[model samples]
Structure formats: C-alpha cells, structure tokens
Target: MDKKPDHTGYWRTNLKYLLILLSIWFLVSYGFGILLKDTLDNISLGGFKLGFWFAQQGSIYVFVILIFVYVRLMNKLDQKYGYREK
Candidate 1:
C-alpha cells in the first residue's frame, strides 16, 4: 500500500522558494542595477562598476546560479515527498 504525499506542504514550500528566489533576482537586477546604480557605482568589481556589472552581466550570472539552486532545491523537495522517477 502507498501512502498519500502531503501535496499541500510540498506546494507551499515550492511557492516559498519561488518567491524568495525571484525577489532576490529582482533586487539584484532592478534594485541594484537601476534604482541604486549611482550608489553601487561607488564600488567596483573586476574593473567594472558594481551597478553596471549587475545590469550588464551580473544579473545573468546570478540568474544562472539561481537556476542551479532551484534545481537542487527541487531535487531535495522531491526526495522529501518520496517522489521518484520511473
């Protein structure tokens, strides 16, 4: 006999992860890259201004990283729910 998984808990956690990750991306890309560009410009990264970096390249890097992070998180989530691929 198979026990039912707690779908409610699973989806709740998934949504939480999505919101948090998206918020972080938004903050980095829009907040730092645009709204706070002037302030961030005071700092530098690899010869480029921090703000410009985030706007031009940093956001893309962070997004790719976030993709991997989401994958790892979902993998663990699936395990927690006894989800397995056939």
Candidate 2:
C-alpha cells in the first residue's frame, strides 16, 4: 500500500508563522501608526517623527523584512519535514 502525503503538519506550521507575522505587521502598522502615534511622535528619527516614519516608511521596511523571514522559515520547515522539491 502506498503512503499518503502528509501535509497537515506542514500546513499547520505555515499557518502559525503566517498568523504571527501578520500580527506583528498589524501591530507595527496600526499600533504605531495610529494608536500610539501621539506617544511615538515625541521621538524624532532623522527629522521625522517616529510615528510618522512608521506610518510612511518603517512599516514597509518591516514588511519587507517579514517577507524574508517568512521565506527563510518556510525553507527550514520544508527541509526539516522533507517537503522540499528535489
């Protein structure tokens, strides 16, 4: 009998990472940009208020970083689970 491909574990791990990364994205974008704007505005970053920077530039940078992080995490997960394409 042939063994069925087991993807549930891999999918679960993928979803977990996605949820965590998305939560971080949401916190950085919404929390810093809007909810905590007043507090972060008191801090200056190269002539731009911290909150404004997060709203305009910081979040984008973080999102890019998160993309790389997700890629790396998935690669490792694939290797660990023997799911990588030969």
Q: Give one digit per residue, the lDDT tens place, for model 1 in 1-86.
A: 99999999999999999999999999989998899999999999999999999999988999999999999999999999989899
TM-score of each: 0.95, 0.91
lDDT of each candidate versus the true structure = 0.95, 0.93
- Off-target runs (Cα >4 Å) in candidate 1 are none
> Any idea what lDDT model 1 has?
0.95
Cα lDDT of model 2 by residue, 10-78, tens digit: 899999999999999999999999999999999999999999999999899999999999999999998
Instruction: Give candidate 2 regions above 4 Å deviation.
Output: 1-5
Collision pairs in model 2: none
Scanning candidate 2 in windows of ten residues, the lowest lDDT window is 1-10
TM-score of 1: 0.95
